[model samples]
Target chain A: MTESQFPQCRVVPLRMLKPETSERYLNEVVKVEGIRRMMVNGPSIPAVVPYGPARGSPNPNSNRRTIKVGDATMELRVQVGSITFEVEDAGVIEEIRKVTNAFFTQFPAQVLEGKFMKTEASLVDYCRYGPNADPSVIGLVDPRRKEAPVIIQGRK
Target chain B: MAYTPQYGPGTSIVAENRRKQMNPNYKLEKVRDVTDEDVVLILGHRAPGSAYPTAHPPLAEQQEPDCPIRKIVKPTEGAKAGDRVRYIQFADSMFNAPSQPYQRTYMEMYRFRGIDPGTLSGRQIVECRERDLEQYAKMLIETEVFDPALVSCRGATVHGHSLRLAEDGMMFDMLQRCVLKDGVVKYVKDQIGEPLDREVSVGKPMDDAWVKAHSTIFHSLAGVAFRDDKEYVEYIQRIHALRTKYGFMPKEE
Candidate 1:
């Protein structure tokens, strides 16, 4: 099949950290160092857009934040690769800190340490049928640290 | 120079002189007398009310009606008389002539039997010829017209039994049970409709997660959204633990 036949999905590079480092230490370092560097060097991230109606019942006590863009609703959940930070309203920055902390905690003494090289984020739209909502997404975001190509030529 | 008659004298004398020159001893042997039985005659036998007698009939033709079996043996018929009769009857059916109604059916049958009309031989050739003649006979029979006996030539052997009849029977069964049944079209329509409705409503829940994950550069660059949920976090943790323990890394594409 030709390339045109396939629907393009995001592909990104990831760097996993050693397990010796502490999550607390990694999270502190990432919030101070990593986020600052990305904000300074990289382009600004796009705004969050809402997708659709909430299908399931929202948690009563937990702050259920939903952002609306057009016909979509956005929900926030905190994930850190392997470790999750149960932060209230843990937006994109907090989510990044959690992932960076997990990475460093997982891998400690590597040159490309304490952070993932890249990641692919997809915007899923889900439908609610009673308490059970199906998980489906539309747009995708793929971010990666640029890598230099290594060239090797045959000696004639 | 002037031409002159080579022989000069009476005409009979000149003729005798030419004969003598042609044959020196023209009448040497004396004539012999003929007996009654020795009187050989040309066109001798006379038939009644005819000028000349015809040649006598052959020995077989002259033989008596109840001639001994050994003396006048009959030709053994290769195929049974009944079979020939049936073939004749079949030929006289409505299947006579190159009609479009049976063309497809016959061609399919021929193909199934690996019979090529262009290069028919052995029994296949014979069967095709027989079938054609039978079709013609059928037409004649339908029109109530009698035809002369058809000459049977040696044809190629058509292997296997009457599979055409069996296939026809199967087709008939299919037409009755499946094609002609009610609600078949509706059932097919329903199968197509359900999938379309289900597809439109897909993808609502995952939209929320995407928005939450990529809200800022920190989350997007750090790749934290990959493990945004509890299940994903657990899965990643298991992978990390396994990798740390085994010194194995996730396979890179």
Candidate 2:
């Protein structure tokens, strides 16, 4: 694929410190009618308490709850680390920035510009989901795990 | 004989910052005043005003082994009180945060005693007597070594050190333990990401300029790279050469 066909997303990484803040940010950003697809990337919210004395217990992080993104109701698998917006064009980047700045202005949130995700499928994508899988989903695939991960909508 | 002690070998600002922290004589500047109660809440070890849970009977109650080493080394207050060993972990952002795991370990080893410190890629955990941990934790939290946005109070889900910082200059926490409010970063949950009863304000993160200026980590992205520091690179080369060459035999001759 040519460089233009490569990841064209003008990434406005809205990195929030807290999951609730991130969840709120996600809810607001998705509502802004700007351009193309938007996805948040961050460290995964583990299914179990990964370590310490409470290891193996169900991770009941409140911020790991499902959030409304436009019309779609999606469970946030990871604490929304940073939100990447794939605008239809560069025009909406400024609009999204205005909405984000109003919210993140009090705190230390930044507006970083770049191509955050891969537009093309990788070896892992082929190994896990196959060739016909959506390009958007390719970037979302967990690079580490090939096996199916249980996606729980509600915290157990 | 009085001999000058060297902090790590480096010529960069990162190296200078390391020396400032490692030297006990150099007082760490206060960054914020997170109340003692707020600190306890964030730690999630015990409740405010609660008695410290003990692991064993007080030192006074235990029979002394006639070892002279015991007499020479005075027991810490927490040990005397039989306080449980508790730990506080910090994950410093790699994007030029004031301190990182190795630097943190080096500083703690020099300044504190009767402690056990564990260093990982992004996080550093120090285990000490409960009361002592609290004291050390306070110093660590209040001092320049910590920036609420850059250094996370993470015990379990400490995955965001190397990750790109969020818009607000806060480290990425999957658990979302802390929130950046009006101007302060508050702990909505404990270090391990357990929900707290009340919000514990850790204080606002340092501005970008301050965080960058005080950071000890050498990263090409934000701060000076290790390759650029000729003396540091030479020191590393010298150490590696000596270890490989003389490891087979103590003396080259």
Highest DockQ: give the candidate number. 2
lDDT of 2 by residue, A44-138 (tens): 88767777655775665555776654455666777565667666556567777777777775554565667776667768778886766655445
Residue-level lDDT for B151 in candidate 2: 87
* lDDT string, candidate 2, B28-134, tens digits: 99978977788888889999989999999999999989999999999999999999999999998888889989889999999998899999887999999999999
Candidate 1 wrong stretches, greater than 4 Å: A1-27, A30-54, A60-76, A82-156, B1-253
Query: How far in Å is the alpha carbon of A46 misplaced in model 1?
Result: 20
Model 1 chain B: which ten-residue window has the lowest total lDDT?
B186-195
Kindly report which residue pairs in candidate 2 clash with one another.
A108-B168, A109-B167, A109-B168, A110-B167, A110-B168
The CAPRI category of model 2 is: acceptable
Query: After best superposition, candidate 2 residue B156: deviation in angstroms?
Result: 0.9
Predicted model 2 interface RMSD: 3.7
Q: What DockQ results for candidate 1?
A: 0.01
For model 2 chain B, the run of ten residues with the poorest summed lDDT: B166-175
